[model samples]
Target chain A: MAKIPIQVTVNGQTHQAEVEPRTLLVHFLREDLGLTGTKIGCDTSQCGACVVMMNGSTVKSCTCLAVQADGAEVTTIEGVADQGNLHPIQEAFWDNHGLQCGYCTAGMIMTSVELLQRNPNPTAEQVRAGLEGNLCRCTGYQNIVKSVLAAAERMGG
Target chain B: MFAPEFEYHRANTVAEAIDLLSSNPGAKVMAGGHSLIPLLKLRLARPGVVVDIGGVAEMKGITIADGNIRIGALTTHWEIESSSQVAEANSLLAEAAGGIGDTQVRNRGTIGGNLSHADPASDWGTVLTALNATLEIRGPGGATRTASPTDFIVGPLTTTLGETEILTAVNVPVLAANQRAEYAKMAHPASGYAVVGAAVVVNVDGHTCTGASLAVGGAVPAPVRLTSVENALTGKELTFENIEAATAQADNDLGGEILGDFFASAEYRRAMAAVETKHALFHATEVAHH
Candidate 1:
């Protein structure tokens, strides 16, 4: 198969590469770009472990083809923080004990970032609904919801 | 979980897309890839070529003209869910769009792909059928045609669309001042696909029902318009008892075997279809009264 050229901006960095047509966004991020924060949990679109923001909207990176994202802006888990400091959402997750095994944290945090951006002062039910796509096997989701609320408050919402 | 290697063609225009499809008989038109990509990764569908229409500028937006809401084929589910215009015109469509899959799925899944795929449990199929939405299809040789949801979807995962045809847009009738619609569903917990989804649209004058459009999905192979329920509700008082009685005919128009799975049995789905129909009707009536 011929390689398709693509230009994608990730975390304020623009990278140009030629990849196979079958290369998924998640694979291109992890393999070519060495950004392993975006985990491939289910490989299927069902698990939101591969969630990333594409053009300001959360999308499952495992299902999005690399060619489809050509010339598009993508923000992965690695882009959430400022330098060595953690984003407020990440700090809240740590302060609120939002993870147990920490497998689904990256996707969870990324999704919450968009959720709060859309709804500054989301209710408990709204947070739950917003994070419906990302699932955590550990923590029972109680602390995750608390983390999102704490982030909302810390952000002065 | 990697997809098989295939040729990729990004069409700059609708004509280029149709031409690619016509030339590559084994090619598939990919918009959002929420449906097709999964199949590709799972090895369920193996096409020789993939024509990516995601960048086609003409097929991406929502507009209202001539009393109809026209949605471009590439419009994502999240766009529809958040569009204030769509909500103002038909809140039921917005509600249905919001309830599809999950937040991530909504961001990438397209309404045209969902309808063109014709998944039996797709929420849009039931809602679009109830709303009497029409689809515009473009094929090879610059041919164009329109089809209703019922006429376009023939069976489960099957559509009347030719292999070389591309769905360009979907046009839905705007809700009248006296009209109200709602979609109610019993969603499968894991997949979020509808186990039994019902959509009801009614035009009421004072307390009398002047017209009704009722449709159900996930109960049969394809989304079905419940004419029996429509007939039962038309010209009747829009009361709780009358609505319940009318919804009882939900299964009367169904003619084929109901779908059954571990999540829901065929018998349970049949019962829930009627229950959901009643629920949708009650909500639509409440909205109408308000």
Candidate 2:
């Protein structure tokens, strides 16, 4: 198979490369770009461990083809923080104990980034509904909801 | 999770996409890739060439004209879920889109891909059946045609759409002033696919049901219209008892073998068909003699 050329901007960095057509966006981010922050869980698209921001919307990278993301702007979990400064969502997650195993934290924070962007002042129920795509088996999502709420308040929502 | 190797082509226009498909017998059109990619990774679909129409500008949008609403094929579920146009045109579509999958899936999953994939448990088919929506299809040499859900979706993961045909748009009639519509679903916990989904559109004249259209999916091969129940609701008062009596006939119209999996059995789904129908009608006619 011929590798296709795709120019994707990941976290404000543009990289032009030839990738196999079968390469998914998550693989492109983790393997080709060597930005391993995006986790791939339940590669069948059921789990949102591979969730990332593409053109301002969150999508399951495991389900999206790298070729499909040609010329698009992508933001992985690595891009969430600003110059070693934790984003408000990340700080809230930490302060609120949103994670126990830390496996789903990256995806949860990424999803919260989009959710809060969409709804600045979301209720706890709304936060839970918005994060339904991402699953966390250990924490039971009680603190996750609280983290999102706490983040909303921190963002002056 | 890698799909089998295949050639890839990005088409800028629908004509180019059509040419790509017509030129290769083993080619498949991918819009959004949420449905097809999963199938590909599962080895359920193995096309020789994959034509991506994700960036095609001609196949994306939502519009209303002449008392009808037109949603382009590339319209994502998130677009429908958040669009005030869709909400005003048909709140059922917006609500159904909101309930489909999750935020991530809705953000990227295209309506064209969902209709083209035609999963048995997909919510669009049942909601479209209730809306009497028509699917717009285009083939080689500018050939265009339309089909209802029944004619378009023949069975589970099967459709009458030709190999070279591409779904261009979904055309739905705007709900009338007296018409009430709702879609109710029992979504699977893990996958978010409908375990049993029901959609109802009813016309009422001061609490008297004048006409009705209802469909149920997830329990059958494809969305099945409950004509007997539609008849049962006509000229009847909108009451919980009447709704229960009417929806009890859902199983009668559900012909053929019911699809079953570990999450839900055929018997359970068959029985819930009426229950979901009642839920939908109750929602459609909410605050009406409840």
Candidate 3:
């Protein structure tokens, strides 16, 4: 099968790619576009390892087809920072030791950014529930919850 | 993991979608792709043509008509979880939607797809069954048939849906006054698949049960309403003792083999079904009384 031409916007930049019809969004981001920040831990949807904000909502890019995202805006972990400055969510994760292996950090931070945006002020339980999709094998999720709360506080949520 | 080669057609309308499906025997509908895509990747489902009905906007929303709630087939779990109408009219549905796989899965997974797929462990099946929800289906013949939740689902990963049939909407009655319901489940840690789940509905009349509906999920090839439990609870006082007695049939009702893995044994899931059934019934009774 010939590759389909898809137009997508990622990290405020528009790009065109010829990809197979079955190409997953994660591969388009990592392999085609050369944005390798999004890691693939488990090809299965169980791990939140490939999380990305698509049109303002966090989704596992691995599960999303690239063609399905045609004309849709995407934000990877690389796009979270503004003007070379770390986003508040990133700073909170770093300061609170939210990650251990750091493999799940990008997805955790990205998912948390969207979570805090929807819920400015969230309880610890809310944070846990919000990030339930993203899994961190290293951290017992205690610090991740703390990091999300800390980010909310920093954002004056 | 690349899916097998297949022609893709994005159908913008139900009529067009039906036409596409009618043209091929192995055409499959894709909405959100949360369920179908994984099957494609696993090679468990190999459709000759992938009909993308996700572009159809008409098959979406939550509407109230004639005191019945009509939810479009494409309405995502996130939409249902966040919709105030769902929360107000049918809080049990909202609660079940909220308990699905997770935020990402909820954002993309549609209730209609979930119900049509008829996954036995899905949250929607147990809750919808307890509510006696109706499925509005459209097929190649352009005829619409409504099936109750119990009738819609035939078995695991199977439904009454034909090759050219597409689920259009789900209709649920606005719960009667003084009727309360709750869903309780023991979630599988890794995949978030429910090990044993139960949805309990109670109608209270001055401390006496006027109506009761109990359904169990994640314990068999399909979710089933527990008539024995319903009989035990009906006309009984809303009390913890009554709830426990009613829930005792959970194990007996779950006579079929349960899907088990390293996470839980079949026996464990059966025991948890009774436990969760009791828990759901207790909460439903509490909500009805107060």
Q: List all candidate RMSDs to the true structure.
A: 1.6, 1.3, 2.1
Error of 2 at B133 (Å): 0.3
Q: Model 1: which docking level applies?
A: high
Interface RMSD of each: 0.7, 0.7, 1.2
- CA lDDT, candidate 3, residue B102: 86
For DockQ, the strongest prediction is 2
Candidate 2 ranges with C-alpha deviation above 4 Å: B287-290
Residue range A21-125, candidate 2, lDDT tens digits:
999999999998899988988897777888999999998899999998989999988898899999999999999999998888899999999999999999999
Compute each candidate's TM-score over C-alphas.
0.98, 0.98, 0.95
- lDDT tens digits by residue: candidate 3, B13-109: 9989999999988888889989988888899888878888877898999998787999999999999999998888989988889889988998888
- What DockQ does model 2 achieve? 0.93
What clash pairs does model 2 have?
A: none
**lDDT of candidate 1 over B1-290, digit per residue (tens):** 79998899999999999999989997988999998999899898899999999889899999998889999999999999999999998898899999999999998899999988888999998999999999999988889999989899888889999989999999999899999889999999988999999998899999899999889998888889999999998999998889888888888877678999888999999999999998888888883221
Candidate 2 on B57-111: residue-level lDDT in tens?
Answer: 9899999888898999999999999999889988998999999889988999989
Off by over 4 Å in 1: B287-290
Instruction: Tell me how each candidate scores on DockQ against the true complex.
Output: 0.92, 0.93, 0.68
